[model samples]
Target: MDFYLAAVLQGLCFSGLALGIYLSMKIFNIPDITTDGSYTLGGTVTGIMLAAHIPQGFILPAVLLSGGVAGGITGFIHTKLRINALLAGILVMTALYSVNLTLMGRSNLPLLAFANLFGNWALTGSQGPDSLIVLLVITAALVFLLGYVLRTDFGIAMRATGNSESMVRALGVNTDRMKITGLAMANALTATSGYLVVQLQGFADINMGIGIVITGLGSVVIGETIIRRFRVVQPVSVLAILLAGAVLFQLALAVTLTLGIDPTLLKLVTALFVLLIVSLPRIFQSRTA
Candidate 1:
């Protein structure tokens, strides 16, 4: 039971990341590689701050802002300098790798001895609700916030820009600003997830974000596959799909683990899962046609 609960908690953490990726990839039509670096940046920043006696209450917001800044930089380069979005993301991600190292002062940071965001509650013998409760709460808040934001006027403009930049520009909307805002918000959520993850795990590893983009993209694809047939889609439904995909992905991992699969091969599994999910629609369309 504990193992299952832990897996679900971990899934919720990854769900936040998946939501971020979905915003960039699906909503904004942007292929962002900066997520890989931003995830680590969030963890590095949170872990270092906590280790340095910073108040745990501020760590999450700090990490979230750092992520937004990192993503905004990439957006600026892409929009202002007219750089390709893909190349811009790669450049920002490359720079963030060094920045993350500087933030941690090393390749990793240990938070085992530090006061974590949930440490006080845990110390007070609040065993009824573990860190999992915190994870769920954070995830729910993000979902509600994002859902609300996406329904606003600016959000509609952002969505329109994603569908047709030229059309949005003709409508007197600043497409560049929309792009930057969307990217910044997406990466902020990604970083926030990383921050919460490290707090739960009590450690932050620099290499923890390896293949993170792939994993996030896979989760989005999986979610879309599950929810593609919905007749009436809502933001809540989309959020639920994202979380469900994360849980399903973790279930796959659990199955592999039970089968004695090596942990290192998980990346390959994620890639394959993405490939299958992405191709399913085309396959079905062809069959029906």
Candidate 2:
């Protein structure tokens, strides 16, 4: 596959991760670092199930629930134990490394010949971009579903809890409950991305989730820039931009690779991209002021 096309497909796979970050960081105002662990957990579960010949459809719920549990643990520690949110996430993430290894029974699992969601089937093809098309459709559907959910009364309460915990609680909402729910949902979505990535890449590695949060953050930053420029605050608008940001970030990496850049510098480049994303808003605001 062409680098550009592959990048687009790659973007679609990671789009869910971006949405997860947006939910935890931007919406819930929590930096649930459990993302790193839950992501690997998802891939671990998926690889194990697929390699074992489990029906593909039956495995997704397991993947989601696994991530939710990881997130819930983080939320529990943060809310009940009063640990710092970052520390809570770190604790869970650290534990999950061992948990993931136990689940996989090793450091790596290969699905090279396993039938996957992106593999040839009666309804789907195995040609180039087939996975991309599958992922694109799923990603679009998720965006719409997420947009609809965010516009609901419960969703408004969730959003409110993020914006102002006191205000929401005064209105009879359970702030702690909302935070737990939000974090679980965020990590569940993130795990779904891992599920897709492992299948697409044909293997699951114990270290795959390391620093993945940075990639997701970069995508969210890119999306935020577009929204800030247009001043659109709608949930649907945010979702659209996030998806676009994921694609753009992937495309940038693909372009760099195509230009013959050393793969070793990719991490450095990613860090610089994130720095730019973080700084650009402040830079623009200062100039305008």
Candidate 3:
């Protein structure tokens, strides 16, 4: 039971990351690799603050704003300087590594003694349920706010721009600004995940974000597959589907580890899993053809 509960908690910790990837990859049709940097940036900031006995109240917003700035720089480079979007993300991600290292002053920081959202007495439950409840609140509130935002006029324009940039530009929407704003919002959410994760795991590492975007992408692909298979047509249902996908993804990982797979091979396994997810749709199309 504890093992399964831990898997669920892991999913909830990464829920924000899955949503961020959904925004950038599915909604914007861009593989915004800024996720790798922004995630660690959040963890680094939160870890540093808690170590200094700083107020926890400002940690999340600081992390979110830092992530937004990182993403905004990437967007500026891509839109204003005509750099390829992928390259722009890579550049920012590389630069953020240095920034994160500088802030952390080391490769990792332990938060086991830190006062955190899930560690307080206000939760009124055991550690497992308490963690799950807090994460659920954050996830649910984010999904609600995201649904509201996506239903607004500007959000519609953002989606339209993603669907057809030329059409949206002709319709007088500033596609560049939309892209920039979307990237900022996406990274902010990604950073929020990082903040949650460092708190849950009791440690923050510089390498925590390494290859992490793949996990987010896999969760997203899994979510999309479920939504399509079930014919879930509501825009809001996507959020629920994503939450479920993250849980299932973590469960799958737990199963692999339980099966005695070498821990060192986990990254390779993830890569293959992501490859399978990416190609399954194409394979299905070919079979139907």
Candidate 1 lDDT score relative to the true structure: 0.85
> What's the ranking of the predictions by TM-score, best on top?
3, 2, 1
For residues 1-289, write the lDDT of model 1, one tens digit per residue: 5666666777888876899898899989999999999999899988888888998768878998999999899899999999999999999999988888887878878889988866666633554256767777778888888888888998788888999999999999999999999999999989987987898788998888888888788778778877876643788778878888887777766776768878878888778877887898899999999
Q: Which ten residues in a row have the lowest lDDT in candidate 3?
A: 116-125
The clash numbers for all candidates, in the given order, read 0, 0, 0
Q: For each candidate, what TM-score against the reference?
A: 0.94, 0.96, 0.97
Scored by lDDT, model 2 comes in at: 0.90
Of 1 and 2, the candidate ahead on lDDT is: 2
- The number of the candidate with the highest TM-score is 3
Q: Taking the tens digit of each residue's C-alpha lDDT, what string does model 3 give over 109-204?
A: 999987887887457658888888888888999888888888899889988988999999998999999999999999999999999999898888
- Please report how far candidate 3 places residue 8 from its true position, in Å: 0.9
Task: Name the lDDT value of residue 19 in candidate 2.
Answer: 92
lDDT of 2 by residue, 1-289 (tens): 5768888888888988999999999998998899999999999999999989999778899999999999988999999999999999999999999999999998999899888987753344445557767887889887998898899998999898989999889999988888888899899989999999999899999999999999999999988888988998888878989999999998988887888989989888888878987997899889999
Ranking by lDDT: 2, 3, 1
lDDT of 2 at 117: 88
Residue 135 lDDT in model 1? 70
